[model samples]
Target: MTSQGHVNNVIYNRLAESGRVNWTRNLAQFSDPKYQQEWFDLMSPKSIGLILASIRTDFKFPMTFPDRVTVLHKLVTKPDYSSDRFYLEAVMYSEQQRRPAAKCFEDIVVYDYRAAKKAPLKPFMVDELQATYDLQEQRKEEAEKKVAELQTFVQQVEDSAGAA
Candidate 1:
């Protein structure tokens, strides 16, 4: 079984290799300076325990090295009702093809490593994650709208050409 930490590490490495420093940098900025040594300290080994309850991955297309890809990670479930459990969805988009190459849906549980049991997520952290998800949804909607508009324009052009 792949651990959540392992998956996170893989994504981090891929983003770094793709020269997407901004995405990683934005995530790192989530840590509060007063409590954390660094931005990643929020998920640091000493602070939090994350278990990968389940994961489903689907590949829409073959991915190759050196292909610029953008991975968008979003919180798929609200943690307010069940603070110990949540879902995150990651979509890897191929820039060259302008489409999604792969996607992963992960169910994660917050754990108490010291107690060896499940733990409730902090309210603040949950709020931040929800906000991030909202932003992602907004962006996705805008992109879809743009694509629809472009498709309509192309169809109009094709009809005019056919008539001529």
Candidate 2:
């Protein structure tokens, strides 16, 4: 049973390695602070909505709020990111955008929690994080190998137990 956190970590690493986290290409336009804020605001609603929609059930959203907050905090604090101010504003804008649907989307706390933890972002820091991810992937492979070996040993033990 893979936990959701593990799955998300894997997805994030894959995206980073593949250069899918290409913040530079889109964010290059944000050389100006004003433009950066606009871009952040635009991306915020879509990002939040997409994240919310990704929840498997309505209940999971509340349960994951803490983790969401942590990620947002990282986003805001990480010096690698370029447009922290805009990201914060964008998250605020997204919260406002959903005001009309407050009744249906009662879990606005999740968004608020996330926004409050907003860390400055490192647009296109994928290359910077690549080594870190490579180490993680290496560790994952080693763990898998160990698990496979353990499984083989367990099966052998079980087979001997049955034979005896």
TM-score of 2: 0.30
Question: What tens digits encode model 1's per-residue C-alpha lDDT throughout 6-89?
Answer: 233255334422332343246547745553343344344565655668767676766555457777766776568358877877
lDDT minimum window of 10 residues, candidate 2: 100-109
TM-score of each: 0.65, 0.30
Candidate 2 per-residue C-alpha lDDT over 1-164 given as tens digits, one digit per residue, 9 for 90 to 100: 14542333333322232221234324435354544543444334532211222211111222211222111101212133333332110111113223211011111111223454434333433333333345556776999999999999999999999999
Q: Report RMSD (Å) for each prediction in the order shown.
A: 6.7, 16.1
Clashing pairs in 1: none
What lDDT would candidate 1 get against the real structure?
0.64
Q: Which structure among the candidates has the greatest lDDT?
A: 1
* Candidate 1 Cα outliers beyond 4 Å, as residue runs: 1-25, 30-32, 35-39, 59-72, 92-102
Model 2: how far residue 62 lies from native, Å = 6.3
